[model samples]
Target: MTTQQDPSRETVDRWAFADTVESGSPARKPGVRLGPAIGAAAAAALVVVAATVIPQIRKDPLGAARGTVPQTPTGAPAAQAPAGQAPVGQESLAPQQTPQGGGGSLTYANHAIVGPGGACCSTSGGAWTAAGTGGYPAYTGPVRTSADRNAWYEWNLGRPASGARWDQIKIRLWIPQAQAGAWVRITVTSTAGSASNVATFDVAEQEYQGWYELPATFTIGTPDRRTGSAWVKLTYLRPYTDQAAAQACADGSCDRMAAAQAEFLWS
Candidate 1:
């Protein structure tokens, strides 16, 4: 009678034979031979599985090893801007500067020509022949004239635009001929109640001839004074002297007067 061998022992033997074949061993045991067809089918199945899984592993080896794709933490903070810098799309809080005027020559709104003896040259200074004739409105003392005669060219500058402040004020004068110790006094008045601001400029000798600039300074206040109240006066002080009278009135023509031009700066 054939003895029924242990089933567990047979299974162990079959596995041991398969391990030997995988290790390149050509030896086989009697009655424990594996079928050639079965071995080929198993190898084909392994090939199909390797073909499908190896490409995926090659694509993402780290993810395959970790068994999951890497991800950012949901609670991580976002990037921030540098210190003292505004964020994107944020409005700036710093003050901005807006400058106005100073484009061209400044125009006068009102003018007055006061001749010697405190007399008005015309009913309106604008109607005078020498009001804007590009010549200085001046009077010369005759020889032996005792009184100190003076002439004035008063002008009112237009008010600065709303929300604008004065930056600088400059006056240009053309001195055709020069005289010894000849000078003009410039006075600026902002309001009726405010004191006048004065500056003296010398226009004597050849060095003082031609175009000369007279810079003047005055306080317009923090909020500025009332509009249409600012004015400037150019006074030609003619003192009676032998030398001045002889030189100025010798040719019967006092060409020592100046042509005035003014410019205003604002911001």
Candidate 2:
């Protein structure tokens, strides 16, 4: 015999079938999550969006390569976070920089030259005196008395490549036999534009004799810093003897007995 189904029972069976299809079968279990596929698709879309946007947000390499970092329209680094913190590609600039001064000691030697100029006058030229052979011009005229004494010679050394710093100077002088025992004086006066700067030294009467070597050391009176030429003058302050001995070249031109030698070292 055929039986008729109840409406409520049919409806409940269809609902149960749909729930199983949507969730899971009774023999099996559901997964830990149901949205991983959607999540992965969303992540891929995000990557595409970043790829399209990052280039626009990044700094221009051309400007950075030229050392002129690209800036925002507001005159700040385009990527600066906020504080003085450097932008993305500038980690190497953290260290800072500063300048540096001079040193070392300098040394020099002393040298001298004599008879650089030719000799003039003969023994018979004047009062007539005899200067030994090796001596240039023979001594002539009366002995140099206190009234007739002058002891300086001046010359030009031209432009100096390395001018003298004047730490120390050694002067070697030669006086006539008649002038021996007289006070030998040496004065160094600046002949450059500033002539008033002068240095003076007196060889005592006791020290005055034939062939004397005087080493006078002095600090250079401030540097003149004058680039051009300068003159050096040496003068004798006092005359040695009071009487006029025969045939003395101390007064007149004496290539023989009167001469001066000097040596110096500078920094």
Candidate 3:
């Protein structure tokens, strides 16, 4: 009993004696205290951790609380049109072009010799001859006479493009000054039996000698597919006079009544 008590009491007495002797005062509690350098280093480390974690939490508070990264929403791409095709609601609405010419106009040369209603005119006596050396290749017809007071010249303009709407019709002609009071009537007819209004051109009103343009409003139907053509008829309607009869045979030449070309203008 003496031996066991002595051993335990000796251990406790030795720790108390050493603390009291080293400090030369009452023994202090056994604990650790931080030095100035270590305390500052620990405080800086805590500041660095707070700075890094606080920004992350501020940027995405819910994500930081949930411990997950935030996700962004993505949108689908837009639709595109096929190659060589127009986009929807952006299709072109321009009028179709003609084969003869472009720029909203169609030109045709007058070369046929047949008149309207299959009526034949005498071409043996040079009544209808090419107006050679007259700038444009035109055909000259004899002046209207008592016997042949009405001469209808026809031009077979080929079929216009489908749905073509011509606003103006033009004819190029040459009328001599001697036929001052003579007149010509222009009309358009299709093989589909559609006809336009009569357009009259009077020499007395125009006073044109060499080349002149006769324009008219075109409001009739377009060319038909039946014959694939439109007929432009120029009727020379003038009462024969003694002066016209004398001037017709002057110098063995008929008065120059020529038609060169015809045109259809688009709106």
- Provide TM-scores for the models: 0.33, 0.32, 0.33
Tell me the lDDT of model 3 at 178.
Answer: 41
- Record all residue pairs in model 2 with backbone atoms less than 3 Å apart, i.e. clashing: 182-240
Local lDDT at 171 for model 1: 42
Score residue 165 of candidate 2 by CA lDDT. Answer: 42
| Clashes found in each candidate (C-alpha, N, C closer than 3 A) | 0, 1, 0
lDDT of 3 by residue, 1-267 (tens): 011111122322211112334546777889889999999999999999999898887887763455443343553333455776555335544445776543243443222233222234212222344433332224233332211334445555453454433433344444434433334455554332354343444443123454455544344343322222345555555433455556544542233343434443333
lDDT of candidate 1 over 1-267, digit per residue (tens):
111212122322211112334567777877765699988998999999999989888987753555443343674444455777665345445545695434333333323322222332211122212322322434231111111234455645454454333322334444434332234455555533443343444343223544455544333433233233445555555432344556654643342333343333333
- Model 3 misses residue 30 by how many Å? 99
Which portions of model 1 miss their true places by more than 4 Å? 1-148, 160-163, 174-182, 191-196, 200-202, 205-210, 223-229, 239-256
Off by over 4 Å in 3: 1-127, 135-150, 160-183, 188-196, 204-206, 220-230, 239-256
Worst 10 residues of 3 by lDDT: 1-10
Q: Is candidate 1 or candidate 2 better by lDDT?
A: 1
Candidate 2 lDDT by residue in tens digits, 140-248: 2222222224444432233334434433333344444443333444554433333334455565332333445544433333232333332234333454343442244
Better of 2 and 3 by lDDT: 3
Off by over 4 Å in 2: 1-106, 110-147, 155-179, 191-196, 204-215, 218-257
